[model samples]
Target: MMRSLGKQTVRTHYQHIVAGVHDPEHDHTHETRQTVYERPDGTFQINYMSGKRFVMATNDGSFECVHVVQTVRSASGSTIMSVIAGAQSLAVNRLNAVIEFESGDRWIEIEDDETARLAAGLTQTAVGHFYHEEERLEGRHLRRWFVLVGPSEDLAVVGKVALFVLPPHETSVDPEVVDCHIAGYRNGNPYPEFAAEIEALAAATDLPITPNYMGDPVVTPPATGRTPGL
Candidate 1:
């Protein structure tokens, strides 16, 4: 599952490893690789890194070792459309929204009254103001949509979709965190990049996209399918 504050609170243990080697067969020549565990804390401490290359041989076979360390987070909010709508109510105008998809494309939707209202009240309280907070009120016109993703029954892929919501954003970022290691993978591996795309898209709009782990977005033109009115 994607790391979020909510999940971290309930289940705090997590481990991920990404390794790149020149040859798989040669790398696994040894019957076992050394495993070490040290001081466990909220932070990840890199125990070591190998600067020299060395070989080893037991009764087993010729072997080698590499040392490394990395950090991980176990934590997790918000909608863009409502913020746009609230901005409109605050007499802010000329807003545009760009939602980058998990696939390398974007779905752009123009906001109307209803859509703007959906997006408006979704903004957080501490951030309760565009210009200022004391004047804040809900039910402003704004546009909004949602994406829910989880493991599929088959367990090979993640399930995801984009849907419109009638309510304002009700979610909050989680506070829990855990240490983790991320392995390098193929280009298709979704990680930091998906989150990065959203950051770029947010720049196009007057709205602010929180820096969360939805990963980087793949921006493209807006979706082409029929969409319900805002």
Candidate 2:
């Protein structure tokens, strides 16, 4: 006798037939026993010892069978070398912007601006690079400035300036330094407009003037010009 079963009914009928013939005490020396797995996606995976096989039923009421041969082979020396070369090439292509200062201190720029901004809030000191055009009589020439906001002592010497903070906003870039007062400078020099305020604060705390030099090359700003509501 022969009978056809629907997709949903096939699983139940198949399980019943398989259970009736399955041997629990079968020996594996000749061949491995069949194993059935019911997937959550309403699919059955039947495994055999010889090779891999997949039986799939499609929505068009057709069955597709795939047989994959499994083989084990040792890696050759050339294959291992090729894999290492590919890994090295991938690493070189994914390198990020990093800076090493003369004082042996290194600062790696965060890939994301928002993440960098959040990180800056956890520290009392921060350094950033900004692009601004000083409004001079010479038609506003663009200039790149490195900003440092930290303790007076750290700012006083170029070798001590270690903090590096990426600006948050893309356009109106500004580094956020928390609980820091009486410190703000650009290109290792105190802001000209805030010179009086800085001097007063320094005098009160006996802080020395920061050197007028940055020990490393000026960092290029990621973007130029100001944007509203970035």
TM-score of each: 0.21, 0.17
Q: Write the per-residue lDDT of candidate 1 for residues 1-48, one digit (tens) a residue.
A: 221111110111112232322333212111111222222332211112
Per-residue lDDT for 1-230 in model 2, tens only?
A: 22223222111111111223433332111111123344666665543223434445547544444322222223553333234335533432343424332333222233343323322321212221111111121233222122122223322212112222112322222222111222222222223433433233334333342222222222332332332110
Q: Count residue pairs with overlapping backbones in model 2.
A: 0
Which segments of candidate 1 are over 4 A away from where they belong?
A: 1-104, 110-137, 142-193, 213-230
Q: Rate the local accuracy (lDDT) of all candidates.
A: 0.27, 0.28
RMSD of 1: 19.7
TM-score of candidate 1 against the unseen true structure = 0.21
TM-score: which candidate is best?
A: 1
Q: Give per-candidate clash totals.
A: 34, 0
Candidate 1 weakest lDDT stretch, 10 residues: 178-187
Error of 2 at 24 (Å): 72
lDDT of 2: 0.28
Model 2 misplacement above 4 A: 1-97, 113-118, 125-230
